[model samples]
Target: MTKLEQIERSIAALCPKELKAFAKWFEAFQADLWDMQIEADGQGRQT
Candidate 1:
């Protein structure tokens, strides 16, 4: 199976509490990525 499929299966196996924690972590992870992209865009525009 693909790595993504493995990740999906592993996430599906998480218990309720673990899933909640993972969701929170994932949200923060996404937010950080977004912030970094915005910063990079701003820097590019300054050139």
Candidate 2:
């Protein structure tokens, strides 16, 4: 399985309470990473 799939499976095994918190944190972290990539790439553009 892919790395992400593996992580998902592991998260699914967690207790519901922990899983809910983890899901929210993971989503926010991923959004931050995506935003960082967009900003960095924009800075590197040839003009």
Candidate 3:
């Protein structure tokens, strides 16, 4: 199967507690990505 499918299956296997922890981690990961993109955009505008 594809890599994304593999990840989906793995995530599906997580227990309730593990899933909650994963969700929290994923939320922070997404926020970090957004912050990086915003910083890059600001730098580009300055140049």
| The candidate that achieves the highest TM-score relative to the unseen native structure | 1
User: Which residue pairs does candidate 1 place in steric collision?
Assistant: none
Which digits, one per residue and each the tens of the lDDT, describe model 3 over residues 18-42? 9999999999999998888889898
Model 2: per-residue Cα lDDT over 3-23, one tens digit each: 999998898799999999998
What do the candidate models score in CA lDDT, each in turn? 0.93, 0.89, 0.93
Q: What is the C-alpha RMSD of each candidate to the true structure, in Å?
A: 2.9, 3.5, 2.9
TM per prediction: 0.92, 0.66, 0.92
Model 3 pairs whose backbones collide: none
Which pairs clash in the backbone of model 2? Answer: none
As for lDDT, the candidate ahead, 2 or 3, is 3
Comparison by TM-score, 1 against 3, better one? 1
Model 3 regions lying over 4 Å from their true place: 45-47
* Superposition-based RMSD of candidate 2 using all C-alpha atoms, in angstroms: 3.5
